[model samples]
Target chain A: MSEESDETLLKRLAAGEERAARFLLARYLPRVLALAQRMLGSRSEAEDVAQEVFLRIWKQAARWQPGGARFSTWVHRVTSNLCIDRLRVRKSAPLEDAALIADPAPGAESRVAEAEQSARVAAALQSLPERQRLALILVHYQELGNRETAEIMDCTVEAVEALLTRARKGLKDLLLKDAAFDAPVKAVSGERQ
Target chain B: MSAAGLDEQRLSELLAAYGADAARWPEEEAGALAGHPDLKSKIAKERALDEMLNAFKVEAPDAALSARILAARPGREMRHGTGVWRALMSALWPEGPVWVPMGTCAAALLFGLYIGASGALTAMSSDPQTETALLSLAMADSVLEENWDE
Candidate 1:
């Protein structure tokens, strides 16, 4: 049923129900894809990572234990680990790695500026160390709690907070040095909410 | 208010690390910082950072990506059948150490071997035809000996 929880859906999935797989895919695909994209900075690579994560989910569903972690958390853990592994392998060929660039050719002039700004943000994110970037993505974008992010990162909650602080500072430094947010960043400290 | 309350330094650090949104901040810190007059301007600065960070939106993957992931699955056909025997087995020992059935089979084999050996021994001692054949052979040998003596 549509109202069933992820654990119930997993039980059906383990029993080979096709609809359960569809349900899981529909619910988690966007989140996983977004995480993968943010982690890897490549659309094609993120897609591969998402596919691998789902494949692992299918294999592990039958043996999934409910008490340890929620299904969504487990899925994010898988996605994060796979993305990190891919990033590790890409370290040797760092020059080959490039973030996906968006083209806003057909849009209005303001839209083009927005697209360029988005690209700069993506580049700044990609420039961060893998762990720092991941910490930012988990807390800021994924909106997971500190404890949950710690569990995924295999660290304590304090460590996660420290990582986030450093990430925020690092992103600020990167954006300031570049000309991307120069106009508004100068006024950020004085700006009122 | 100073001992358990959020001081300016800690509140500033929390704002820098977590965001302008008090809800996203750690519960203990959020509670301590709530309605604290010193934190208003600090939170306003943090809000600018949060807005900048939130501006980077990730586009959803194409439909073809979903199709690819779906196609890579091992599929429903590869799963075990849901027959009564299978269901019962799954219920009993869904995943296992696998030694239970093996131990039972070994014990049954040993019992069968023991029964077979004891039955063979009993049959060898109890058969009338075999006993009669032995007695007849002994009598014929003694009769031959008496004829030789004569």
Candidate 2:
């Protein structure tokens, strides 16, 4: 079957199509898992957040309307809010443990180098104020524009831009200071150049 | 590349755009690279940094991880209907269903009518004196006994 749009699948599910439910779950589940994993860091917690996000999707899908907001955008808002709430419970789950950011998948030899970079990014992110970190993440990885990012962050566009300015500088300082960042991207580049 | 410093605002703008998609470049901003020798070098440096950040995509959690996470879904982790309202009235309410105060109001009205009727009936069934008093009170046309003639 051609992949159903989120709106269509939601409408079908509302109309009592069980198959639509499964299809909906299968499609967005992976990415939501990744997002949760990024926020929670543990495979276990990410899994938990993933399930919660979908089950919410299951309950709410029927009420979803097209053109209200993009499904991807909605998911980011929902999942990101949940993550932030989870962070605030002071759950003793350190953002530090789950703190590492991920880059594109790299070859085996460069994996160690990438891990180090992830670690630095995580630390830098931790050093930022919560709002700033949230603002940065929404824009950086979530790919939300300033307007949407501001909405999610509950701030103005000017505030988001200001936060982004500081956040970029922070990331710059973090990366430049990391010893691992001095290493080359490809396996061969470090030794050759 | 020259030793000129990057203007902080413009440089941050480029980085923000680059973070979303490394290939994206704002026209006039990147176009400024040609005219300003200083900006030309900073542009190259910024592009390099953007590329470096893009190099590490976190491995998407494996399929098994997805399954595991999906299974472990948080929020109401307990078996369904553990909440106060859910525990008290889960079977009562369903999604999108509108509940009127219908049932409660019916029970209440029934109770009120029963009390009023029972009280009236008790007055009817009472001893003769009470019945006479009620009868006199309810009687709109009854004539009073002639005490003035005496």
Candidate 3:
């Protein structure tokens, strides 16, 4: 209903109301799916992870405490953790984790040049160590507070800051080398958004 | 700006709120974000960098996927249904310490009734001599039954 606040729905959900659960699932599943797709790089895997995240929320809704944390934040943390676990298991192929380190820079050129630059940056991100990838995603992309990012990363705020700094610096060093931006960049978008 | 223009805490706060909605942030930290000169560039940097990070859009589960995940084997569905009921009950009305004593007393009362009923039925169905002896024993009580030495 138009008058239902998230907390009210969450309370109903905690009380095992199926209608509230359906509402919660409808409201948040897209975001969870988007996050899983971005982090895990596979639609099938993302779908699986999204289902698990929903079922988990449904099963454990009673454990939630109101006014404790943002529901989105909690769900985002769970989705991120699940994606990381899936990524860790894909060790067989010659994947493009660090392929952006080899991409060209954007010289005095067109929007295509900017796209190329972005492509390199994206490549550099996937290449980083998993912890650095997560820290960067939380702070730089998701814009989570340092403390929240640290909590999601299961580390200290100081560690998050350090990881951000390293991730950015690493990206810069890789993206800026050999300033001649004449190399033909790939037309594909990054693996994750 | 001086070299000591921004503290580390303020810098982190500025970076945290730069690209995101300021309203979602704590007021003190949001104030720091607004006050800091570098917030815009840091957010721009983050935005640009985020683009380079793959923007993978995950697909939602289709009916087939949902069907597979929700499928149960044998009597598993009934078990899960019961579990859901238990979860709902626990959430609605948490159990306290009273259940233990209530259960124990109920069990004891049930056991006492069982023993008394069994003894009576045995006495009723027994041989005449045995029944008379038992009846006399019951009437005379502990003195005859225990031999009274102690």
Cα lDDT listed for each candidate: 0.74, 0.58, 0.58
**In model 2, where do residues sit more than 4 Å from their true spots?**
A1-3, A91-110, A178-193, B1-37, B65-150
Each candidate structure's TM-score, on Cα atoms with residue i matched to residue i, is 0.70, 0.57, 0.51
What is the number of residue pairs that collide in model 2? 7
Q: How well does candidate 1 score on lDDT at residue A107? A: 63
lDDT value, residue A73 of candidate 3: 76
Which fraction of the native contacts appears in each prediction? 0.50, 0.14, 0.10
TM-score of chain A of each: 0.85, 0.72, 0.68
Off by over 4 Å in 1: A96-110, A176-193, B1-4, B77-150
* lDDT (10s digit) by residue, model 2, range B49-148: 5555454344555667544434433332232345675444424532221133346678899999999999988877799977776777688425334433
For candidate 1, write residues A166-187 as lDDT tens digits.
7777677656544334323321
lDDT of 1 by residue, B1-150 (tens): 442576778887887788788777776666666667777766665676677767677777678887777667674323434567545544554332234655888999999999999988886887797666666676765754566689
For residues A111-139, what per-residue lDDT tens digits would candidate 2 score against the true structure? 77766666555555555555666666666
lDDT for A13 in candidate 2 is 66
Clashing pairs in 3: A97-A127, A122-B52, A122-B53, A192-B54, A192-B55, A192-B56, A193-B54, A193-B55, A193-B56
Worst 10 residues of 3 chain B by lDDT: B71-80
The better candidate by DockQ, 2 or 3, is 2
- Per-prediction DockQ comes to 0.20, 0.07, 0.05
Q: After superposition, how far is residue B99 of candidate 3 from its true place, in Å?
A: 32
